[model samples]
Each structure stands twice: as C-alpha cells, then as structure tokens.
Target chain A: MTMKKIVLMALAACLALGTTGVYASQADDINALRHYFKKKFPTVPFKEFANGSYALSADKRINWESMRDFPPFEDHVAKGEALWNKKFKNGNSFATCLGNDVTKVRNRFPHWNAKDKKVETLEGNIVACQKANGEKPFGLKKGNIAYLSAYIASQANGQKVNVVVPDDKDAQAAYEAGKQFFYAKRGQLNLSCADCHVYSAGMYARGNLLSPVMGHTTHFPVWRGKWAKKKGDGFGTLHRRYGGCNKQVRAKPFKAQGKEYSNMEFFHASMSNGLTIDAPDYRE
Target chain B: MKKMTLKVALLAAMMATSGFAVAMDEDSYRAEHKAATEALNKAKKVGGEWRDSRWKKSTAVKVDGKKMSYLHAAEAYAAKGDYKNAMKYAGIAKFEGEMGYQQAMDQKNAGPRH
Candidate 1:
C-alpha cells in the first residue's frame, strides 16, 4: 500500500475506535465499581455497605445502633408523610400528582430521562409533581422537601437502588458525564467525589470516618449530628450534603438541583444498585 | 526608673522595625499589598481559594477564610494610611494563608477511604 493510503487507513481505524468507545454501557460501569469495592472490603457483606461508616467500623456501629434506637429522623419522617398526603388548594393531594403507591417510587429515580435529555432526582420530581398540581414546590435543600423525601424514602425501606442508563444516546451520555464528574477533581482543593468516596473510603479526615462508596447511595436525607445543631432544621437532602462537602474542600458548590448535581446523583445511585434503601440514616 | 526607660526604648525600637511605630509611605503599602496577594496565590495553589475565606467550615485551615478577609482589611487600612495596621493584617493574612496551603498540600487527596 502507498504511505498515504496506510496513514489514511490508520486514521480511519482510530476514529472508528474512538466513536465506538463513546457508548460505555451502564451495566459494565456498575459491575466494575461493585467489583472494585467488593475486592477492597472483602469481609464486609455487600448489603451491609448501605449502613455506611458503620459497616466499616465496629465502634461507630455501636453508636449507630444507639442512635437508631431513638431515631432522630422520626419527626422528619412524620412531617414528610403529612406533606406527602396534604392536598393542594385545588383539593388534589400530592398523591394525585405522583400517582398511586409511592413505596417503590424512590427506586426509580436518578433515572435517565431520554425525553428531557436529563437525569432527574426524586426531589426534583417531587417539586415537579407539586408544580404540576398547582401547589408551590419546596426548595431542594431542607424544610418540607427534606421531610417529604425522607418520608418517601422511608416507604421504600427495602427497595433496592435501581438507577438505570437506558440504551438511548442521551441517556448514556448523561451517565458518562456523571461518571466523569465523579472522578474529575475540581475546586481549589482539587479533590473529586471519587477521591473521598472511592479512593479514600474508610479513612479519617477532620475527625470523621469516611464510608465506602458501595453503600453511599442507599442512604439519603440523613440526620447528620453536626447539621442537627442548627436551630429548626436537622435533616438534609443528598444534594445539600454535596454542597457542604464542596464547601469543605474550599470549592464553590453548584446549586442543589442543578444539572451537574442531578447527573452526579444518577451516577452515585447507580453505584449502589441492589443495596436496600436506608434513608433517614444517621451520620456525624 | 532606669529599667523602665530601657524597656520603653526597646519597645520603640521593636515597633519601628516591625513598621508599627511609624506611618508607612505609598511604596511600603504597595509592597505589603503585593506580598499579601502573592502569599494568597501561593496558598490557593496548594488548595485554597478566595472562596475558602467564606467557607468557614473548611477543614483545610480554620484561619484560611479569616486570613483571606484580613487581606481585604489590610487593603482598607493601607487605603486609610494606617500602614501599621495594614502591615500587621497583611502579615497575618500571609501567615494564615500559607498555613492553609500547607495543610491542603499535606492532606492532598487524603480522605476517609485512604
């Protein structure tokens, strides 16, 4: 073959491979991450990772057990239940907006919405549902939203994390972006979400133990002890904690319900698939 | 009385050397400001930011945000011709900013998993 022909052929091959490589199946990524965690913490049961730091430390487990006995989040859950059932001014309840049976609802969230070309969170859907029903939506952080999410999550106590990236190009791209965000280091600290949850799991920073990423998704709307100290609000959503973590690393945080965060939540939730729901969980 | 005189004289000399005993010229103010800014940049390189000053809960350095604010305070003092306070605040900002930088660098990528 001529040199020109050989070069052209090589270029064609490279472009082909690059184009094909763009579509990494979500199932493959989930398996790889799960395998990595399983290998790292071989002794810990896969389901137990849902317990977060408690799964890794015996001392913390004792405290976690005690904390669960009182269940500080009980009040929040109760409030959430009321909000979930409360009717809109039009005499339609949140149920009318969300449809019947919310028990398995949390499992379906952080899903790739091909139609919207976006990843949607349960919290976002709740807001959307309320807006659809003529009721004003709550903000993404604390208050009625947190309580509402807590209540909904509580109903799905045993439902597994089942976020999926469908076959659609947009859906796949969203998942890839989320995965990239997880690993991409940002902020002045130059720490990625993976740097803490994946690479540094079970380590200590600032007097707190870090939990493995394996079970990170199972819990949400956690009743954090540090957060509880603030008057009038103790509960926090997954995105609010993300904001706090970003600030801790000296980075400017994105808005709680922003696209980047939603993509991230989709990726994080995907990682914890098959793990049972454990929201209203406690944390330091 | 002799001892008291000696103490007063020593204090005056110390203050003069530290730039706390006299009004500073524009050049001195500029130099101090430049040094503070550079120190802040250095701090940022090791994982601090202008925003770190607002993130009071940052574990990297407790004084980082406070020190960053001092940079602003230093500039204000210099603008008012209070170079003594300006230099003092600048020095503090530099010290704390560097401390934050060092901590961030040392703890580079260190997390619970590690």
Candidate 2:
C-alpha cells in the first residue's frame, strides 16, 4: 500500500477507537445509575425512577415578567435604583464609570477584558467601578451589591446579551477555559456538565427537565424555589448559579465570586449572547 | 390438626427471624464484607489519584453496583485524596440515597409478602 493510504488507515483506526471509548463510558454511566436505583429500591422499576430523579418538573420553568412584581427581589431592585442614584464616597455615582446612562449599562457589560485575559461579567465590572472610585468593593456574593447587580442586569431585560469575544489569544484562552470548566466532569456521580445539560437535557431528573445550557443566562435574578424560603423572594445571580451547578454535579462548589466562577459566568453568559434577559423568573 | 398447627407456628417463627436477620446492623455486616466491595464503594465517593480535576470523580463510576451506597464511594474517594468528589458523593448518599432507602423500606413493610 502507498504511504498515504497507510496514514489514512491509521487515522481511521484512531477515530474508531475514540468513538468506542466514548460509547463505553456512556454505557457504563447508565449501568451504574441503574444499579444505584435498583439497590436503593429493588422493587422500583429502574427505567421509570432513573429519569424521574433528574428530570425537570413542570414547576421549574420560568415565567419572567410575573416574577418582577415579587419582593425582596423587587425590593432589592428598588434598593438598587436607590443605590444607582446614590453617589459614591468620592461624590460620584456609577454613572461616572462611563458617560452612558446608567439604565443602559447592563446591555454593554460582561465585555472582554484584554488585561485580565477573560470576559468580565457585569457584576465584576460594577465592582471595578466601585474600586476605581476608591469605594469599598461590594462582596460579590452578599449584601446590597448582589441585589443591585441583579437589578442593573434586569434593566437590560429586553435587550440582548452582546458580549463579544475578541479574536485575541487572551479572550480566546478565557473562552476555552470557560468551556473546559463547563464540560469537565466532577462529583461522585463522575458526571460532566455536558452529561446532563447537553446529553440528557429534556430528560427528567427528579421531576425537573435538564434545561439545555444554550440560553440559560438569558434570565437573571431568577427566583429559585430552593432559595425562596431563605431570601424571601430571593434572587440568584450568575455566580450563585454557577455555584449551584457545581453543587448539583457534586463538585466542591466554588466561592460565589471567585475567578473560576467568573470565568464560568463569562462563558455561560456569552453562550446566551443573542438572547434577551428574562430576570427574576421562578424555578424549582 | 396439632401437627399442622405446630408446622404453621414454626413457619411463622422462621419468617419473623428472617426479617430480623436481614435487618441486623448494616454497618457491622458491611465492615465484615469483602474488601473489594468496600474499596469500590470508597473509590466511588472519592475519586482515585487522577490529577485532572475533570477525572476527580472517575473512580466513582466503578461503584455502579446497586449494593454500594454513595457513602462507600465517598469513603473510597476520600481515602484517595479526592475530597471534593468524596464530599459530593457523601452528601448524595446521606440525602438522596438515604431517602430512597427509607422509601423502599416503607414500601416493603406495606407490601404483602408470600
């Protein structure tokens, strides 16, 4: 055989091997889940219960506008409005960050930062503004800062997410890192984010349909049932959502406002770039 | 008639004893069980030493058997220094697995057994 033909054959063999490995891993995962279900409830049929645990129930879906009137998230929004109008310790409001109107800020945010080698979420940008003004940076996970951030993002509710990943290597690297984090497997289930969000999406896991991550960040300040009791009309930011996903996957969740999470938020928000915001939606 | 009644009583006693035997302390029995079963369970919880953080929970895939609890996998992963996955599995085992086990027990108790 010619040298070219041999090379092609070798490549084909490698591809076939790679395909088989992926299939075997998926099959193994399914079998393991089946066995887990069986051992826990021997009488419960595996096929029925397996999908039930992870499935998205009807209640988990979002109704964005309806939630806007709900309070403390609404109350938080009111507070954010107050904060936006309030001047910094430097006697200037966030309006000084850029000459643009404060109302339109969220749409332009989560922009690429060449200096940081990553995309900055709107919240991060806001904190930067506070820091630049010589004011104390608001804790990303807590207090009025998070609420105000969510409120600001909500102002762009009808506007589309338009974060641009520059062609430069730094932006590209951050995007790739974010992608890797999204697909990387963690937790005791040995499951990757793709395992459920991409592969098993639309399948039920405990009465919740695994939503495709495609347009996930289109919504913000979502009213999660899990947090409703605690926050009293609580709102979850992009960072908090990232933490929740990690917890669900059984990985040690990252801090709500850390670099890893920010990178993840950057990628997640970017994925929904064209979609409009749907803030304060209800979810199970 | 007496002979038949005695036989019935013996059968009833056997059934009662069997249930108790099965219900005997699970922890003690598990401790005495085969090492592979225990190891597999532990490994399932804490991922073995695969450096890739992505591979942190890979060992958990081994405990696919129903007989093993998430706790077993967590223990195994923890032993192997995969604390993140170990803790994750441990939480699942404690919450979801336990709830499932209890539900199963409830169903069994409610069901008619021949």
Candidate 3:
C-alpha cells in the first residue's frame, strides 16, 4: 500500500475511535467490575452478594435469615398491592400504564429511554403514570410510593437485574455520567460511592458495614429497622438510600429520579446484571 | 520634619491596609460577607455544595440567634456592629466554600481507581 494511503487509513481509524469514548473500554466495564469483586472476595458465591453485609459475615447472615419468616417489609408490600388496584382521579390505575402483571415491572426499569434521550427509572415512570392519569404524584423516597414499589418488586422477586446500555450515543453518555458520579468525590467528607462500596466492601464505616457493589441493585425498596422507626414507614426506594448515603457523606443529594440519579441507577443496575432481584428486603 | 511626617503617614496607611486598624465598619463588613456568600453560591452552582457549608436556619433562639451557622453568626455580629467577629465568621465560610469548589474541580475527571 502507498504511504499516503496508509496514513489516510490510520487517520480514519483514529476518527472512528472518536472523542467522547469508544465502546471498547466501556462495554466490558460492568464485567470487569464483577470480576474485580470476584477476585477480591474469592469465597463469596456470586449469588450471596444479594445478602450484602450478611454475605460477608456469618453472624449477620443468621440474623438476616431469621427475619425471612416475618420480614418487617411485608405489610408495606401489601399496602403497595392495594395502591396498585386503586384508581386514579381519571379512573385509570397503575395497571393502566404498567400492566395487570405488576410482578415483572421491577426488572424492566432503570433503563435507557431512547426516545427521551435519558435514563428512565421505575419510580420516574410511576410518577409519570400518576401525572398522565390526572392525579397527584407520590413522593419518590418513602411513604406510599415506596410501598407500591415494594409490592412491584416483590412481584419481581426472582427476576434478574437486566440493565442495559444500548448502542445509542446519548445512552452511552448517560452511562458515562453515572459512572463518573459513582466515582467522583463530593461534599465536605470528599467521599465517592466507590470509596465504601468498591474499595471498602465488607468493611465497617462507623458501626454499619459497607456493602459491596455486587448485587447491590438486586434488593430494593428496602425496609430498614432504624428507618422504619424514623420515617413513617421504614420501606424506602433505592433512591432514598442514595440520598441518605449522599447526606451521610455531607454532600448535597441530587433529586431522586432526576437525570443525575437515574443515570446513576442505570450504571449501578448494569453492574448488577444477572443478579437476582430480591426486593422488600430487611436491613439494619 | 516633613520626612518624618511622611514616614508616619505611610506607616498609618500600611497599618490600615494590613488589618492592624480597628475592626471593619458596616461597609467593609458588607463586602466581606458578600464575598463569603458568593463563594458559597459558586460551590452550589457546580453541584459541589456540602451539607455542612450551611444549615437550615433553626427557629430556636439559641441557634437562630447566630449560634451554629457561620453565616448566621456573621449576620448577627454585623447587626450588633461586632465587625471583628463578623469578619472572622465570613472568612471561615469563604475558606470552606473555596475548598469545596476546588474539590469539585479536582474531581472533574474522577473515575474508578483500579
């Protein structure tokens, strides 16, 4: 080949590689994340991460398993189921937007909305559905919204977390934004999400153990014993936990289901791809 | 005698500018307080605002009376014409805000360590 032609071809290849990022590095990001944890925790069975701190502690596991019979979140889930059937002012219900089969709705969200050009969350859609039906939207963090989500999650109990990053550029950018947010140090404490979840997994932060990133998204709308006593109902969506964590680090929290957090949900959910969905779970 | 007068005048001006003079007056205190607020706003604009940077203004007489929030204390001091205390609190807020902004910039490209 002529030298000039070879140079032209090389330039073309570089252009194809592009400025924002090529998929080569990002495509395997989730896989590499899982592998890193697998390497760090050789003894943990891949499925056990759903149990979080319990997975790392035998004593904690016993305590967690004991709560399985009469989980504190059960009542909250039933309340959610009732909300599912309750009609809006316009007479439409959650079943109108989400189908009668609510059990499968949990795994379907925190997905890329190609048409909207942003990450769409289950809670966001719930609010949207409420608005579309001419009803006041529920709060995103706790209360009836969390209870309804808990019910939807219970329905999807055994489903796998299936977050995806599609081929679209906006979708990729959203994922990248979330990844940056996850790692970026913020607030007075100057701590990132990865600081505790990735680097210090199974380690104690004050009294509570920092759970790993693995299977983190599998459990959601959790009912915490402490939170149950504080916030009217202890059942809270994952976004509530996100807000709480950001506050704990002394950082100002982004609005739940807003672009910043929804994108974060996209990234973190993808990291937990293939993990079983275990919703309405209990935690200390 | 003229030279001596000039030397004294220069020393007096230096002292004023070097913060060896009496505490700031209302106008000077206003300038300092404004600067602290601006730094805090800048940090907030970049989404790097920390919760500790400012707190909810309490209704209690103790904290609402400029006991906890540095900005609040600065305002209370300024109202009482305690420019020394006002300036000190303003300086603390300014430093913290600038630190928060610098941290945001430093972490612009923050990503996975490994």
Candidate achieving higher lDDT, 2 or 3: 3
Best by lDDT: 3
Instruction: Point out the worst 10-residue segment of candidate 2 chain A by lDDT.
Output: A46-55
Please give, for residues B7-97, the per-residue lDDT of candidate 3 as tens digits. Answer: 9999989988766444436667789889989998998777777665565532212334344566767777777767888788777777768
DockQ of 3: 0.53
Best by TM-score: 3
**Alpha-carbon shift of residue B89 in model 2 (angstroms):** 14
Candidate 1 lDDT score at position B46: 51
| Candidate 1 local distance difference test against the native | 0.76
Which tens-of-lDDT digit does each residue in B1-114 have in candidate 2? 999999999999999997665545333334433333443344334322111122333333454352334556766666665556665665544444333233323322121010
* lDDT, candidate 1, A149-201, per-residue tens: 99988988988888777778787777776777677565556677788888888
Residues A144-238, candidate 2: write the lDDT tens digits: 66577766766767776666666676765666566556666655355566677655756777866676554566656565667767754456676
Please state the error at residue B83 of candidate 2 in Å.
Answer: 20
Ranking by lDDT: 3, 1, 2
lDDT of 3: 0.82
lDDT of 3 by residue, A25-107 (tens): 45478778878888888999888888888999888878888987789877888899899989888878999998878877888
